[model samples]
Target: MNNPFPYSEDNKRYYTWSHYLKTKYKNKVFKVALNANFTCPNRDGTCGVGGCTFCSSYGSGDTIEDKFEPLDVQYESNLKIMQHKWPKGNAIAYFQAYTNTYGSVKQVSEMLKPFLFKDEIVAISLATRADCLSDEMIEYLDFVSRKKDIWIELGLQTTNDKIAKSLNRGHDYQCFLETVERLSKTNLKICVHLMNSLPGESKEDMIQNAYKVGQLPIHAIKIHMLYILKDTVLGKSYLQHPFPMLDKDDYIDVVVSQLEVLPKHIIIQRLTGDGMRGEQIGSEWMFKKTIVLNDIDKAMVARNTWQGKVLETK
Candidate 1:
């Protein structure tokens, strides 16, 4: 089994650090999830009150309150962790956890000033909602892309409008297309966040959604299995019905089929993301993160399959 892509050492689709970065710098790049302290439109009453049911008030990822902490401190901590772990890698400042592009242009500028001249930070990846990227935000992103590489991660849990509404996503499918169109005009790379095993979603529905995403102007893809975490609407609902979630085998088939239709050029950012176990409810297997991802990789390799192997032209 021989696949040139570092990701496919065994003639299968697997995540490898070398193939993952695909960088020429001969080093690793770190991601620092910046607490941008930005608020969402949903929380501001412009769209809705409580944000997406699955989103914690602080947004996802490890978060710390204390707005007083200087941005450099946070960046330093993240860089330290990466350096300690890899020792030879560089770093990238990830404005994660919330709508990084929500604030005013001036505010965003100020928030990112600390890393402006940091050579170790080679790129910046922003995690944000499709609707939150305003014209000014685009301008900022455009400006940043010229100076440094940029990646914008848009959260598109499912293409199903009903599920999006149930999750209180605040934006619609049209909005997602519009956002991508707008961002396409920029030089930044766009990565999409797709969730599987979401409530009210069937196998056919998930496949359709993945195909739809493959048609978008996306540079990368990140997939995660939905988990009903504690203190969320999803968690409460799961307790009531306990509808089946994708187990290990189910997930492998779903992922392979989805990948069969996914564009191969699109780097697979992640196959799954494990939410904090203490806060996660139901689907305990999610806690076995490494084993699950490894199993998926092994299965795909054994079958000699890559994403988008199966597609139907409509």
Candidate 2:
């Protein structure tokens, strides 16, 4: 009763990405969220128009470096900043904006090639939509897996069809599952992105989405809390109607419930996401990342629960 959860190696509760990387590579690992000037298929009209309801003008890459500079220049410059902060740590070249696979196989190859041989960079992360990945993209990614570490992040904010439709995500649950199956043929690690406090999602719906992802073949997951930003579709809508949102404590309870169902082997890539200062309009409490994270740790300890403590999904 006096001890914290017993799921992860560090014994905090969940299987964190930091612990996984540090133990596997024997050093600290930081992901450099980079931009490649890519665009989403939805905004381009391949799937839909106007992009996702909540997507920022930066295409969800607000924190990434300026895209005007060449990819190598950005990587090298950012590498220096990271190196100074943690002298012994390594970095992951993360292509974070838009649908990274929207480009041709050759274009995608060029974007990733610069980091393949970089000694200081240990891995590469590519974020994209499930509907945007073509067969050629998979072929090229598979070829790279022989030598370079690759992690593919797919955004599937919510499994609920109505919520996805409302968000204009432009992809269904089946599409996401199919893409994961195809990508599994390669050695690249897979991570699914889920969001809490969506427009119409219930507490149980969030729990169900977590269980669904855990049953899949993914190696990691990123749980983002929905925060309405200014001047976007979601922001405007929030101003008009102001849908119900999760308070800090309610969000903590929902997240802990998810952790109970996810398999211990799966890595928790993110617990909450941040919005650009002066841009986000809702869920203001999320700005304090440390408080949200600390509360999660405390909640798990008080409840005597841990990641995958239930060990059953479906």
**Highest lDDT scorer:** 2
lDDT over C-alpha atoms for residue 238 of model 2: 89
**Predicted structure 2: lDDT:** 0.87
User: How many pairs collide in each candidate, listed in order?
Assistant: 6, 0
lDDT for model 1 comes to 0.77
lDDT of 2 by residue, 1-314 (tens): 54444435665788888888988899989988788988997898888888899998788888766556888777777777888899888899998888898889989888888789888888899999899888888888988977678899999998887889999999899999999999988888999999998987899999999999999989999997998888688899889899899999999999999999999889999998779989988678899998999999999888888888788433
TM-score of 2: 0.96
Return the lDDT, model 2, position 47: 84
List, residue by residue over 1-314, the lDDT tens digit for candidate 1: 66523456434563433465645455666676677677788778889977788887677754543333667776777677668887877777888876888878888788777676788877888888899888888988789777778889999889889999989889899999999999998898898999999878988888888889988888888888987777776677777868778887888678777877786677777777777758887677877878877888777777777665564332
Worst 10 residues of 1 by lDDT: 9-18
Local error of candidate 1 at residue 313 (angstroms): 10
Q: For candidate 2, what's the RMSD?
A: 1.6
